[model samples]
Target chain A: MSDQQQYLIIASHLREAIQSGELQPGDKLPSEARLSQQFMSSRGTVRHALEKLRAEGLISSHQGRRSQVLLPALTQDFDSVVSFSQRCQEAGKTPGERIHSREMIDAGPRLAVQLQCSSSASVLALVRVRLMDNTPTMVERIYFPEEIASHLSDYQSSSGSMYQHLVERGVEISHAHSTVTATAADADEAQALGVAPNSPLFVVNQCVYTADGQPVWCSEQHYLPELASFSINNVKERPSPSFFTPGRA
Target chain B: MSDQQQYLIIASHLREAIQSGELQPGDKLPSEARLSQQFMSSRGTVRHALEKLRAEGLISSHQGRRSQVLLPALTQDFDSVVSFSQRCQEAGKTPGERIHSREMIDAGPRLAVQLQCSSSASVLALVRVRLMDNTPTMVERIYFPEEIASHLSDYQSSSGSMYQHLVERGVEISHAHSTVTATAADADEAQALGVAPNSPLFVVNQCVYTADGQPVWCSEQHYLPELASFSINNVKERPSPSFFTPGRA
Candidate 1:
């Protein structure tokens, strides 16, 4: 095999080991010399493989410590629009949804501003509880303009994906940013999710947009914290040089 | 003022009221009709101004409720490499650091792996609690290679930004992605931040990167939840035409 191809083989094997739970979180890896010998590759090649894993968030390093494995790869793609069904499927779990409420209401001062319409206009509010592996995981309250909701009401609520429904109706789902916080499960959330009040919950406040940057949907999702942890990858910028310090830029 | 700037003027004025606490979080805003009459602009212009504010996270909308104002503005710059000092500065808060530990130590397996170095090599571990407006807000643990730390040791534990220190030594401090979760505050964190043990705290897991995409630093920041909430803005993809499929990619 080519030298470069061999490194990929090495990386894939390690990745599989991680995926299979053979190497647990916080587990240490052997030295580069030992890994090179074991993989039957040059030291540089082994290093290359390790670097790839590190970049993928599978491993971390320190100067004097053995390389340690990160916890099971529980990462969410920040750039993509991920549906509950898609997320559950990726984890090999079953996804189910039950609609709690669907109503068309007059836009009050608050929602009128959000939909960018007059208070007299109407909006459709849909609330649902999502289940993963038969256990309730999240409660979502979504609001859409009447135009969008009219196109979605006839769809099956039990298994239909609103995102997909909107998309089919030619509504472009571009991107969303969310503000997340931890909150005590209120009585309503606890009852819906089958969890006790005061249980730790993840409250995600989200605004979804269209490619043209129109606010298409807004929702608040409350998740049971122990169900899963959220993850994000970041790219940092170098600190401003002295020459580029304030007043000089 | 230019006609195109009218909306901006009204938005900025409302933003100041929200930021200065003239309008508090959860407080209702005057209706759009009222706002248009007050601002002497078209209702569409007023509505546009409100949408801008909502998009910036200074306000929130609910269908049947009043448009509630949010707390003082948070500089939610997800794209930028945000440091405690930088964040505090942006919020007009005085930032200070009290270093608790700064020493070279044996790298553990996990630390070694993250740094991609030999386990026997020394690494610098720095621990600090940061203050905003003289209130302890977060605890940060950082690790660096020995060579990098040595160059920074001259700066007293209480002085110097680690990112700045690294920059001075030609080490790049690029960007970071962070995962935020709500965890029960431990005893140590409770005392340090003067909160009760088991209080909800935001655990931010982050990795700082270099220009070449090298993972240089990993840290876990614990925040007092009452102090803030997290926020992100995202765009959704065009949903697939079929909404019933569970795993259609």
Candidate 2:
């Protein structure tokens, strides 16, 4: 087999070992040298395999030692475009949502800029509380531009994935930009999420764009910090003298 | 000049206007068509210029209307590799630090894995609170491997930037991995940041690496959410069957 395929095969074997309890949580993986010997793959390939598992949070790698199998972890990776419900399913959890309210409203000045639509435009607004394993976890206040909102009338259930539903209806999602911050839960948010007032919530301001660069929707989601967090891996680039605002990001 | 150059020049002019108070906050920018006509550029180019300003938080853009200049904002962009102190100076804010303590400690099993070092290896530990404008904003618990830690002794001051100090000392810094989560402030963190215990804080778990993939240091930073937050721009890629944990990022 080719090097790429060999590495994937090795990763698959390890994944199966973890899933089947062959290598239980807290078990140290075989040393890289032994894995390289057994698979007849170069150490680079072996390391590549390990990195993939690390990205999945299935294996924890510390330098100069064997990696350890981790307990099933629920960590969000902003790098992927997977829908929220699908992700919960992947982690063996049931996902549900309650539509607290929905309405067609005129885009106010603030929402107009956020959705990149004309001021006074008609927009669809949705307020939803998403639950994982029946526990409230996130409160999403989402707005959809008129054109995109029209497609959702038929597939508007919260148990399924809105991202997938839109995709099925031919919404070619191109990208998303998100700003993550923290906020103290207000009375309404606190009640909805079963948290005390002034408890911390992760505020994610996000905009979704179509493939042609049209803004499709915008969402302000408040997430419970206790359950989920964002994992980002950044590589240094050539110095660009770009001055950023203080530790905001 | 090329189209790229044209856009940048336009951005610079707009930037100058804002800084010079020619375009005051709450004032509307000229329409894209007018800007294009004035600059002898395409509407696309003018929009690109506007996008640049939006990224800097200097302007807010809504479709079918003029953009508005914005008040100065303090936000962080994780995409840049600039040092914290430098960023503060760029924003015209004073950055300071108070080093609580420093010591050499053995890398226990937990820390060893975190620093990616051999267990029982000598490690350096530093605890400090980073300040902006005389207000304590973040508490950083930092750990460095022996090699990198040794270089830190000479330049260990709270007033200067450790990132710059390391670079000046010939450390070829690479990229970083960060997991942004939320936590309720403990007594110690609350006392350090002058906030009530159980107030929400942003927990940034980060590890910096070298060019050759060596781990340089690991830090657990607690940020007062009122002062700073992370802004991220994500572009969607080809659909991968990858599953992520729920809304972590």
Candidate 3:
């Protein structure tokens, strides 16, 4: 094998060991001489493999001490709009959804302004708990305008992707505006998410618009922090001002 | 005044009241008749002003019920990269930094890989407590390579903007990659941030890179969630995938 490919292979092997818990957080990695001997590679190749892992923030190394493992954090892309199910599938985890409630109600003042409709307009509200590997991860509460609500009477079976459902129905999905905040879960949220009351939760409020800038749906998702996080890449071309700001559509 | 100008002025008045804590969270707003009488405006104008506040996520309203105020959250834009001091100044808050430690050390395994240097290379590490209005909000630990470290010995006086300082030194910062996760505060982190042991904290790990793709610095910032949150706008054009996947330069 090429010298470059050998380091990649060694890195992947060590990465799998870390992921499988064979190498745990704070556990010291084997010495470079030992790793080189075990992998039948040169010291330089072993160091290159270890450097790859370090660059990924998986292990910490000191000058004279062996590298130590770090707890792996689950990361979610904050720049793209993807369904929970798609995200789970990509991570090789089973995704499930349990419908909690689905009902049609008059658009109250808050919903009216968000939907840009009259206060009396009828809207459909769907609340469901999103699960990863049968563990409750997030509770999503979504509201759809009457036009889209008319098509999904049996939403319980169709709880997977509302964005896809809307797109199939000729509603062109465009961009989304999302706000992420941390909050302590209230009793209702705590029970729904299967966490202690007042546990830290990552709350994401998002509004999805259509191609013509018409608001299609607004959702509030409460996520258990242990199971989820977000990542972003800030390019100099479009500098981000602050970590949290009211984004204009 | 024009009708549009009247509603905006009333909305700003209520917004200022909320900001100043004259109206507390969960406190009911005055009746429309009372507000119209107080402001000497028409009932329609009062309702329009309330709607504006509602759209801003400041207050909640229901049919035939008084609106309730909401707790204001400090939001940071995740897309734009700005200094904490700059962000505070933009929000009309004073920013301060307390240096905890600034020392030169050998590049350990983690630092070596992150800085793309040998373990024998010397790097400068700086730890500081970030404050907003004299209240501790975050603890930042940053590491710089020898090129930058050689020039910055008195970081305490130069703590205003590390990016700006680097820019003034002829370092062209291109972009940064950041990962946001929730973690329980350890003893040192807890004490520095003035939070209880094991309190939930927002941890952001970021690596800034130069224009030519050279890694400049790596930072780990632990934020008090009560004082900070993150915001992002996801457009359809750039679809981000696998947040933890090793990002290519």
Highest lDDT among the candidates is held by which one?
2
Global lDDT of each candidate: 0.63, 0.71, 0.68
Badly placed stretches (over 4 Å) of model 3 are A1-80, A188-195, A237-249, B1-82, B105-107, B119-121, B187-196, B237-249
Worst 10 residues of 3 chain A by lDDT: A240-249
User: What's candidate 2's DockQ score?
Assistant: 0.21
Which scores greater on DockQ, model 1 or model 3?
3
Task: Give the per-residue lDDT digits (tens) of candidate 3, residues A1-249.
Answer: 744568778987997797688987557889999999999998767876775565344565344668766434222333224467666766687778888888899999999987778999999998888887788888899998898787666443433666656666777665556666666677888898877776777667777765344678999887887777776545453223224521212
lDDT of 1 by residue, B1-249 (tens): 532368778987997787688897557789888888999998656765675565444565343445666434533332223466655666677777877788888878888777767888788887787787778887777887676666776775343356666666787654454556766677887788897776677666667665444556777777776665654332221111111112211
- Give the 10-residue window scoring lowest on summed lDDT in candidate 2 chain A: A235-244
Interface RMSD score of candidate 2: 8.8
Candidate 3: Cα lDDT at B18: 78
Over the stretch A52-142, how does candidate 2's per-residue lDDT look in tens digits? 5664445655668787765333223333333568667766888889888989999999998877788899999998898889889889888
Give the winner by DockQ: 1 or 2: 2
| lDDT (tens digit, per residue) of candidate 3 on B1-249 | 754468668977887787688987557889999999988898767876775565344565454888776434222332235467766667687778888888889998989988889999999998888887788888899999998786566444433567666777788765566766666678888899877776777667788776444678889887887776675444343222115221111
DockQ ranking, best first:
2, 3, 1
Best by DockQ: 2
Q: Output the worst ten-in-a-row residue range by lDDT, candidate 1 chain B.
A: B237-246
